[model samples]
Target: MKVLVTGGAGFIASWCRRELTARGHSVLVMDHQDRRHQLADGEEFFLGDVRDATAVTEAAAHVDGIIHLAAVLGTQETISNPRPSAETNILGSLNVFEASTQYDLPVVYAGVGNHAFRLVGTGCYTITKSAAEDLARMYNLYREGGRVTIVRPVNAYGPGQSVAKPYGTSKVRKIAPAFACRALTGTDIEVYGDGAQISDCVYVEDVARAFVTALEHTAVHGPTERPVEVGPLESRTVNDIARLVAEYAAKVTGREPVGIVHLPMRPGEVPNAVVKSDTTTLQQIGMTVADFVPLEDGIARTVDYYNTEWLPGYLAA
Candidate 1:
């Protein structure tokens, strides 16, 4: 299959691109950033923004299917600037759905696995993501030949995870790497609020597999067949993650364990929460919670990857 992957340069989308290429599918990666250096042999690249409908339409012309992963992720980024978040997550998604409808293509959309979307007090990130998902559903319902399979993934961490820059800083990374970097430097791992916020963190490889699996299967558009939620059975607290990252970073880099500092929770962020989807959906998709990579092992691999491959450049910079 010839698949078009938006946001192909991102942490999760990069893994999806790898999984797709490894499974003998040709990939057309569209990202504003040139990630051609990351492409496998026979994979193609397109330099454009998802907000540009014309660029998306042109790219849609050649692909058999679409894996829509482009978005302005992170609560801080979205909450700080709702305008760009809405523009990228909602309008950018509309372009993908519209183009897919026009080309009569099947789509696999990336969705969040948080139940916070159902609850009140959700932030702009959740709000925009929900709106985009509604557009996907509308496309499936109203447009002929429009098929979309949604995959809701949990918090993912692994090799190639980017280190987040400070808020309002130039570089932006994820939690796992942020903690890992702090751990390496013997700096305090900042924990917001009581630090009991729970999250289901899956390995990037596992999440990527779920995306490809959904793409391979025909759209199970039944009313109950919602976005297939994919993640490990186990959940971890933010405090636990901080401790583990510091512990592993010490072991990998021969550094001392870092301290943890509790800070007030950010506004509009969910607290003491964990999320997962129905097991029946996974069973129907030939998957099980047991298939997910164990948290300890996944964290170890992530720490090692950052230490060996990513940390040097970060330090140099």
Candidate 2:
């Protein structure tokens, strides 16, 4: 199958591209970045922005399916520029999904757990993502030969991140590596508010694989079915994540991580949150969570990947 993955150069989408390529499916990664991270040699490439209707229509002409992952993620960033966030997240979905229908292809939009369940201090981030979710559902109908599947995944961490920038900077290169690197440098990892808010984090590789599984099984769409949620069964708190990163840094650098500092949950915060969807939808499609890498274990692996691979690749430049 030929699949076009938007944001193919980004963290989670990069993993998705690799997984699809490994399975011998040709992948055409469409992004404004004009690059695919960790790209498989077999995969194809198309350089364009998701915001451009012509790019999506052109790619949809050749692809069998779509993995829509491009967006302006992060709360601080989204609220800082609400209009861009809205246009990128909401309008981009409309353009891509509309194009997919025109060319007759199934599309899977990457839905975050927070979008369906809680708002938190996410501000416009939640609102914009929610608009896209609604748009996906609105377009979910019996077309000639196209389909829409919404994948609600939890917080994902792995290689291909960018958190090495200065303080108060909004650059998050790689989610897991950024946190782990910060901890190793003895930088205080910031917890938005009270660090008790729970976040379910599946490894990026695992999340990528689940998307494929969801794509393969039509039962996920239920013919009569509507919603699809995919991720691990459990969650960890912000404090829990900080502690795990600290532990990994301690082991790698041989420095003791005393502990995480307590903090407060900001206004409009949604605590004790997890995306709830009908498990039967995914089960019907034969999709189940696999490779439950414990947070600490995933953190340790990510830290090693950063220090050995990512840091050298970037710092040397």
Best by lDDT: 1
Could you tell me every candidate's TM-score relative to the true structure?
A: 0.92, 0.86
Model 1, global lDDT: 0.80
Question: Model 1, range 39-153, lDDT digits (tens) per residue?
Answer: 7778899999999999999999999888999988776656677898799888999999899889888788887877455466666777888777788788778888667777888
Q: After superposition, how far is residue 63 of candidate 1 from its true place, in Å?
A: 0.7
**Ten residues in sequence with the least summed lDDT for candidate 2:** 166-175
Give per-residue lDDT, candidate 2, residue 101. Answer: 77
Error of 2 at 97 (Å): 0.9
TM-score for model 2? Answer: 0.86
- Tally clashes: model 2: 10
RMSD (Å) of each candidate, 1 decimal: 2.4, 3.2
**Candidate 2, position 164, lDDT:** 41
Q: Which ranges of candidate 1 are over 4 A from the true structure? A: 166-173, 219-224
Q: How many residue pairs clash in each candidate?
A: 2, 10
**Which segments of model 2 are wrong by more than 4 Å?**
36-39, 117-122, 167-175, 219-226, 263-281, 310-317
lDDT of 2 by residue, 10-33 (tens): 778878877887888788888787
